[model samples]
Target chain A: AQKVTQAQTEISVVEKEDVTLDCVYETRDTTYYLFWYKQPPSGELVFLIRRNSFDEQNEISGRYSWNFQKSTSSFNFTITASQVVDSAVYFCALSGEVVFGAGTILRVKS
Target chain B: DARVTQTPRHKVTEMGQEVTMRCQPILGHNTVFWYRQTMMQGLELLAYFRNRAPLDDSGMPKDRFSAEMPDATLATLKIQPSEPRDSAVYFCASGSGTDQGGYTFGSGTRLTVV
Candidate 1:
């Protein structure tokens, strides 16, 4: 069984502010995958990042970064200097059944 | 990049009407999935298939919802006697069986039941 939890239901921040969306997951399988997806107003889900259990390395892409910590069973996403265009519903998911979190609606006001 | 394709981007139908949604998975992908998204329930897996065989459909309502993969590329989800509660964005996704990476999702079909 796998479950994902996103504590933040919605978040609002001014433009150029850094925001972090928290994600926690529970899975019994030693080999599993974690993912983050962004659904914009256009109604399309955009893949953000995928991290496997073996790789605990934190990844940074442009203004976006992900922290995967097996110790805490947490995978967090951070957006540095977020812009208005970054507003969207972000979901955290666990693989091998692909259980998704409730998602956090982010609003980046300019 | 190859992507999954879903037909009937938007559909509005009267209550009790039968609604059918279609999907075309990326070529060479062996796994396909169907999901429904709504404000109350973020994303729920309705059904999934692997090698054109139904893997799991326990998430779907067995009475009125039916899913099938008639061929390698095509997948269909039908809801008979659709109700207002069934209105949601249905998404189709595909993944390479060998890849551990996440699946690629389509634009989704937004269905509205009046």
Candidate 2:
């Protein structure tokens, strides 16, 4: 069974400030996929990023970045200089025949 | 850009009524998945198909839910005698392969069983 946990249920930050969303996962499989998805007010799940177990290298896309740490079983997401558009419910997910996760709601205010 | 499409974006029905949701996967994709989302339960995989063949549906409630891929492009999920607890946003996603990059998701069908 693969389980993903996002400890922060909700987070608020002023625009231009940085914020980090924590995600911890447990999986016995040697190889698996980790993903971050954003659900805005429109209720669409937008794929933000995907990381496989073999790749430990951190990734940066515009103001959004992700840190995948195998030792700690954590894949955390960070927003640098976030804008109001960044406010959304972010979900951390593990992939397989079955996927599970808890969600984090992030709010950015101007 | 090709994307997955789902029909009847919003549905409201009384309990015990039969409900059906449909999905059209992007052209050339071989795998399709059905998922449910709610405030309490973040996301749950109900069923998935590979190459139009049912791969895994263990997550689905066997008594009331059924998923099928009748053709290459179409997938359907049906709930017989639906219950109030079945109300949630149902999502359809497709992928070309089992790998990480092939996945693409649709907006989702909001089912509210009253």
Query: What fraction of the true interface does each of the listed models get right, in terms of native contacts kept?
Result: 0.57, 0.60
lDDT of 1 by residue, B1-114 (tens): 999999999999999999999999999888999999998888999999989999899999999999999999899999998999999999999987777567899999999999
lDDT of 1 by residue, A1-110 (tens): 78999999999999999999999999999999999999999989888898999999999999999999999999999999999999999999998767899999999999
Model 1 clashing residue pairs (backbone): none
For each candidate in turn, the TM-score is: 0.97, 0.96
Badly placed stretches (over 4 Å) of model 2 are none
In model 1, the runs with Cα more than 4 Å from the true position are: none
Please give the DockQ score of every candidate, comma-separated: 0.75, 0.65
Tell me, by DockQ, which candidate is best: 1
TM-score of chain B, per candidate? 0.97, 0.96
True contacts kept of 2: 0.60
Steric overlap count per candidate = 0, 0
User: Which 10 residues in a row give candidate 2 chain B its minimum summed lDDT?
Assistant: B95-104
The prediction achieving the highest TM-score against the true structure is 1
